[model samples]
Structure formats: C-alpha cells, structure tokens
Target: MSRDHQASSQHDGTAGDVVVLSQGDHTLVILYGDVDVRVSEELEHAGRFSIDAARRTVMDVRHVTMMDSVGVSFVVRLAAGLRSAGTELELQGPSRRVAELITLVGAGELARWLPELPLEADVSAEQA
Candidate 1:
C-alpha cells in the first residue's frame, strides 16, 4: 500500500469489540470483528465508504477472530481494486485464526502486512 495511505476502522453494534477506522496521512484500515457470516459485507462497506470519500485506503483484518470465504473475498477484491488504480491497499490487524486462514486459502501468504491489534482490545479476554 502507499506509504501515505493509513487508516484504522472500528465497527460498532456487533457482538465483537468495536472495530476502528482511523485515517492516516494515506492509509485505510478494515478491522475484523467476531465470527460472523456478514463480515464480508461489513468489510466491503467500510472500504467503499473510505474510497468514496476520496481517501487512500488500506484494509486491516489482523483483529479478526474468525474469517470465512466472504471475509476473504472482500479483502482480496478490495486490494485488487486499489492495485488497478495504482493506490495502495493494506490488510492489517489479523488474529491468530485469521493468520492461519490466510495461509489455508493461499492468499499470497501476506505475512508482512499484518498489523497489531489495539492494546485495549479484548478479543477473547472477556469484557467487563
């Protein structure tokens, strides 16, 4: 992704912890929530919104607890779109499960781009 494209996204109103969307000088993040079939939709919605707003975008999924095909496709296609436009697309915030899924799917083994989850997030640590 472009060095200038940096953003963090937080998704609200879900069983998982709040997902974050923070914009850097030039990056977009698509955080992953708890296990859900609708994850793909959520991820795509966030990404399109960011692109529509005319911001350089990157997708972060390092925090994802579990990812299925839907979630996978959303990110893969999103990255393709950015590449076509010469824009940088980053996928960050992947959980351990997500990391394994990436390999299982053979999605180019994108290990270098994964980012760390927020220190405050409680993926499985149980919330108060």
Candidate 2:
C-alpha cells in the first residue's frame, strides 16, 4: 500500500475531508463531513489518483454528513471515467439523503451502491 493522499476544505463554517489510499490494484477513498463545492478540488485530485492507480475504487461515504451538487458531480465524473477505463467504482454506505441526491440527479446507475464499507480490520491486516 502507498502512503495516503489527503485533502480538506471548509465552507460556511462546515468542513469536509477526502482521503485516498492506494493498495496495489485497489484504492480506498474515504469521504466525511460536508461534501460540497468547497471540496471539489480535493475530490478532483483524489479521483485522478484513483483512476491512474487502481483497477478498483471504493468510496467510503459512511461518515458523510452532507453532500451537495458538487459532491454528486464528483461521483458521477469518477464513475464515468472509471467505467470507460474498465475499472470498478463502489459507493459504500451513502446516507439516505446522499443516496436520494444521487438518484435525483440520474447518477444512480453510475456506480454500484453498497450497504456498508469494507471491514477496516481487513484493510489494516493487509497493511500490517
């Protein structure tokens, strides 16, 4: 596994974080807090890294408290790009609100939605 690449953004007194971890052919993208316009740059960077480095990408959104149009667009773009490259994109544990926004924007088909993220212990074991 490679060292993590992380970015954060804040807006309207709210904040968000984007962390990308590359593990051989897999990339884990952990997203949390408010995902909005403020974090678009970081999201873009993370997406590029994922596409370039991995055949499979898992986005963990379980900790996300909010998401807006920018966040949805990021997911859409990442999904489309990865699909074109024959890569897999998994959206793990999106909240109902986030899921609704994605569906509302016609992005539901872009990526596979999961009920939960992969086990942290499994990933940690691999690291060890």
Candidate 3:
C-alpha cells in the first residue's frame, strides 16, 4: 500500500511543491523548482514524514531549477536523521549542477545517487 503527503508553495506565482509518496518500505519525495531557503520548511516537513514512514527514502530532484545553501543543508540534515534511525537516503535524478553543489559541500557521501526516477507505473498505480 502507498500513501501521499504534499506541501506546496508559490511566491509571486513562482516556486514549487514538495510531494511525499510512500510505498511499502520506500518513500519518494518529489521536489520541483527553486529549492532554496524558500522551500526549506516544506522540505523539512517532507523529511520528517519520510523518516516516520520508510526505511529507505528517495528524493526526486530532476525538476529542481536551482539550489542554495539551505537546500544543501536540508539534504545533509535529512540524511543524518535517517542515518540515526538506521534508514538511508538516496538522490534520484539530480541534475549536474545540483549534484556538483552537493559534492562540493561534501554531502554527497550522505546519500547514494540514482540516475533514474522512480517508476512511473508505480506512481500512476498509486494515484488510481
């Protein structure tokens, strides 16, 4: 079974949303747009939900247009939290820029990188 939790924000009609989808022992966090300080709160909330729901969490970063220090912190912190709980974090479909920044910050070791997105069929099935 799967469940979804979503948080969205819009500033001056520009921003993105955080959507959490949990399936079995895996949870997928979908993030879009500028993932800077603006979405930190939503990201944190999603992180908490991920920890509470799954043993493995995957953050979907393919739709992110930009990232700032706060975004990096969120990933690092979330990874730490999950680690303490004996869970794991994975970065799914991160763009080159996002990947670079995370590596530059030395947070790359906190998570494993996946070049592909979660299965569309699974998402669609959950939606139905």
Candidate 4:
C-alpha cells in the first residue's frame, strides 16, 4: 500500500531552519542559516528528531552562513550520538569557509558524510 500525508512545520521565528523530514529510504534535513550556539537547541531538536527515526540522515547545510565551534561541536556530538544508536548522519552544503572551520576543528573525518547538493532555497519543498 502507498501512503501519502501532508508534512507539518513549526517555526521558532529565528535564524534557525526550515526542517523537513523526507520519509523514505533516507531522511534529509535542510538548514537555512547560521547554526551557532544560539540556535543549537532548536537545530538539534529538529535534526535528532529526523535522524533518530531514520537509518540514514542527510544534513543539508548549503545555506549556512556562520557556524561557530559550538555549532560544530554540537554536530560532531550529534554524529557520535547517532552512531551509538546505529544510525548514519551526513552533513552537506557548507560554504567553503564554513567547511574549513569544520575541518580545522579536526572534525574533518566527518567530511565524507557531507553530501553534494544543488544550492537553492530548499525551504519551499521542505514539507514534501
């Protein structure tokens, strides 16, 4: 049987993100902007909410402008946490500079997890 349902969204009215859960073989989480300590809590909630439910999770970071070490730390920790539960986490779409920060922190090992994606406003289709 095929099942189709409308997706729901909750906005925090900050520079957080438009989280979308593409429920199929894998899940994709698209982040729109700065992911620093300020928005970590919300981002984590959205990311974990998706990753925890799927076998593979793709984190789309194409639109990320500024990502502090705190953000990086949270993401690395999230990856580690997900691994413990037998789930895979993938980070994608970081600008070259942002990617450098992630690499400088020695979290580059997670580089392979970043997926290549078209640069665009994915928010429009997030609910799909």
Candidate 5:
C-alpha cells in the first residue's frame, strides 16, 4: 500500500466525505455524510485509485447518513470492475439508510462484499 496515495476531500457544498487509507494489500475507503449524485465523481475517482493501488479494497460506509441510486450504482460498478481485474471489493458497515436503498434496488446480493455481516445476514432479507 502507498501511504502517499491516501487522500481525503471536503468541501462546503459537497454532500459527503471520502477518506482513503492504506492497509497493506487492501485499501480502506471511509465514506461519511450524504452520498448522493453530488459526489459521484469523487467516489469514482477514489474507487479507481484504491483499486489501482491494491488488489483488495474495502469501502467502510458506517458513517454514511444518506445515499441514493447513484451511490448504489457506484458501489456495484466498482465491485464489478475490481472483480474483473482479479481484485476484490467489499462494503462494510453501511448505514441503515444506505442499506435500505441497496436492498430496495435488490442489491442485497452485493452484500457478498460485506465481510462484516454474518453468513445468515448475507443470505436473509431480515438482516438486510
């Protein structure tokens, strides 16, 4: 991992935050605040950078307060890209709102990326 590659962005008008952390073979992306269409570009850039720097990437969205379809699309697309490159992508601790949106989109299957969830939680809608 490249410590120098770790970056964070914050702007008054932006709806969310992105912080990249280097963790050996994996990169940890901490997202906070609202992650709607407003931050799509930032998310995409950060996702690509992390994927390029590490074979495994973990997006920790425990602090995300809100999200929309754009956020869901970003995660799904990122995961697919990483998988195609023989890398791995995982989503950890997504907030209830974000989780609900993902579930509403029938993206609970994407929970395969969420190692923090128990096996039952991944397979059952009750936990989603």
Candidate 6:
C-alpha cells in the first residue's frame, strides 16, 4: 500500500491527523487524535477523497482519542453514500469512548464494520 494523501493540523488547539493509504481497489484512512466539530471540514474533505479514490474504504480510528456527534455523523453519512454508490465503507477500531457515543446515538450497527478479532480470540471468549 502507498500513502497517496495525508493532512494534519492543530485545530482549536487540538492535534488531529489524517492519512490515506491506498492499495489497488482498497483505501485505508488512518485518523488520529481528536475528531470533533473543530476538524469536521478537514475530515469531510479527506473522506470524500478516499471515497472517490477506491471502491472499498477502511477508516481506521484506533488512534483517535475523542470524537463528537459531528464525527459520528460523518461516518454514518459517508458509509451511506458509499453504499449508494455500490462501494463500501468500514470503520475500524474506534476507541471505547467513541464507541459508546456511537452506540448511545443508535449507531451501534456501525460496529459491524470493526475489524474482527482473531478466530482464537473469539473462541476463547465464547468458552469463557
């Protein structure tokens, strides 16, 4: 995979980063730090670029420390748009706080896009 686009900035005194990595028909968007209203514009721009660049987009937010309603809305809307376009959008590894916020807002179904745990891990959890 090659990183074709990246943007980072300090908005409202909070640091945020976006990296777009592409491989064939797949693109991975790595997001870090806070993703709130302050950085919505930047995030939206990046999301659009990713959607246009690949048939499958994976948004990896594991490094994101915080997210607000705007961020959640962005993800939902992006996914919907991609689906309508016959593409796919997946959210990977949202932090617990972000996950709770998404769930609270009735977006828990988005969690289905999260990267699955290893088979061994799933089996152990089931046994436990």
User: How well does each candidate superpose onto the true structure, as a TM-score?
Assistant: 0.60, 0.81, 0.82, 0.71, 0.74, 0.76
Q: Per-residue lDDT tens digits of candidate 4, residues 1-128?
A: 12221122443334655465665776666665666676666666765666566467667777777788767886687667667767767778678987888888877675355556655456557746
Task: Say which prediction, candidate 1 or candidate 5, comes out ahead on TM-score.
Answer: 5
Tell me each candidate's RMSD, in Å, in order: 6.5, 4.8, 4.6, 5.6, 7.4, 6.1
Better candidate by lDDT, 2 or 3:
2
- Greater-TM-score candidate between 4 and 5: 5
The candidate that wins on lDDT is 2
Q: Which stretches of candidate 4 lie over 4 Å from their true place?
A: 1-14, 121-128
Cα lDDT for residue 30, model 5? 74
Against the true structure, candidate 4 reaches a TM-score of 0.71
What candidate 1 gets wrong by more than 4 Å, as runs, is 1-22, 53-56, 109-118, 121-128
Candidate 3 regions exceeding 4 Å error are 1-3, 9-14, 117-128
lDDT of 6 by residue, 42-106 (tens): 77877788767747888887778888777889778777767776787877777788778877886
Question: CA lDDT of 98 in candidate 5?
Answer: 79
lDDT of 3 by residue, 1-128 (tens): 45477766443323766778887769888878888887888988998888876479989888787888988898999899899889899998888999999999999999998867556767899899
The TM-score, computed over Cα atoms with residue i paired to residue i, of candidate 6 is 0.76
Q: 80 in model 4: Cα distance from truth in Å?
A: 0.4
lDDT of 3: 0.83
lDDT measured at residue 65 in model 5 versus the true structure, 0 to 100: 78
Better of 2 and 6 by lDDT: 2
| Residue 57 Cα positional deviation in candidate 4, in Å, after optimal superposition | 0.8
lDDT of each: 0.54, 0.84, 0.83, 0.65, 0.72, 0.73
Which is superior by lDDT, 2 or 5? 2
The better-scoring model by lDDT among 1 and 2 is 2
Q: What is the lDDT of residue 78 in candidate 4?
A: 60
Clashing pairs in 2: none
